[model samples]
Target: MANSTAKKNILNKIKQALDTPVPLPFELNNEAVNVFQPAKEELEIIFAEAFTKLQGKFIFCADENELHAQLQLLISSKEWMKIFCNEDQWNVLYSNTLNLESCDAAITGCEYLVARTGTIVMSAAQQSGRTVSVYAPIHICIAFTNQLVYDIKDALQFFKEKYIAIPSLITFASGPSRTADIEKTLVTGVHGPKEVYLFLVDKTA
Candidate 1:
């Protein structure tokens, strides 16, 4: 009986609190605030430095031809025969080059490249989908200069403007997956790819 009475009192207090909702303790500011200083170098340069610092391999291509040549060279040098790319557009470019049940590397396109944080923004809306990026032992991204954004906020704004209804999944990949959980010893590629490569094609050039 006593326990029931206590439960009733708790329910009544919750109802009362909901009925008399309190305002936020502080006033909310809607003004836009700049948290970081403006970037001094070009977005591409900034992205390259930041990405390389995170142990990502960066390649700059002047055009699609260069990108193709570089990709071929990397494949030959690394001896990666089973390349996987499901995108029709990319498949057309690298015709007769990509086809394998099991892949040594996976190539994908990203929605945006965040320069400030050196991040790759991807969504379920892309043709490659989610698994292509994380499943492969080596993940390679093909990106254009036009897809570069100054910051994550810019990427979010781009998403807001591009999609009326946002995608179900949005992911940000910085570099090869790593963890320092076990014995505080840093280990890479435990959760995802061991190596990550970004080939940035300069469409503006």
Candidate 2:
């Protein structure tokens, strides 16, 4: 009887605490970050390092020929019957002869590559809509060296300057989807693509 009474008292105390409202401990600041300024080479190195840590595959292509060669080799080695790509990049995948619906993988380009966080910034304007990017089993992103930005702020600034109106959808894809909600057991591809590959092309070459 005494223990039951103590339990009731604890429940009542918790209810009283919940009923009371408390102000936040600290004020929120809206100031943007402006300290870091990374060079092109430094950005590439940092992006590669951070992306690798997230289990993303990174490949560098020195020129168009190398890019085609690497892509062809990957397709052949994987024995993929068909490869999907955005219509805008049809010239890049001259050898690809399959339709998007029948493809096992999708290749698309991104708006900007964030070096600080190792994220690829994408928008709905791109041919490969949200469906193709996340639905496919394999995702391959083609990005140029010039697209690399020091951080998210720089990327956002680029968007602000380039687009008159913001896109309906924007994606900051850091890596493949991973879930650890159930029993804390890590599972990849739970909500999105199983694998992601980044082809960093040297447009200058």
TM-score of each: 0.84, 0.78
Q: Model 1's lDDT to the true fold?
A: 0.90
Model 1: per-residue Cα lDDT over 21-105, one tens digit each: 9998988875586678888999999999999988999999999899999998998899887788888768665424444336888
Cα displacement (angstroms), candidate 2, residue 165, comes to: 0.3
What's the lDDT for all of these models? 0.90, 0.81
* Residue range 27-133, candidate 2, lDDT tens digits: 76656646665454767788898787888889889986888899888878998766777557653554264465567788888999988888988998787777777
lDDT of 1 at 53: 89
Off by over 4 Å in 2: 1-41, 91-102
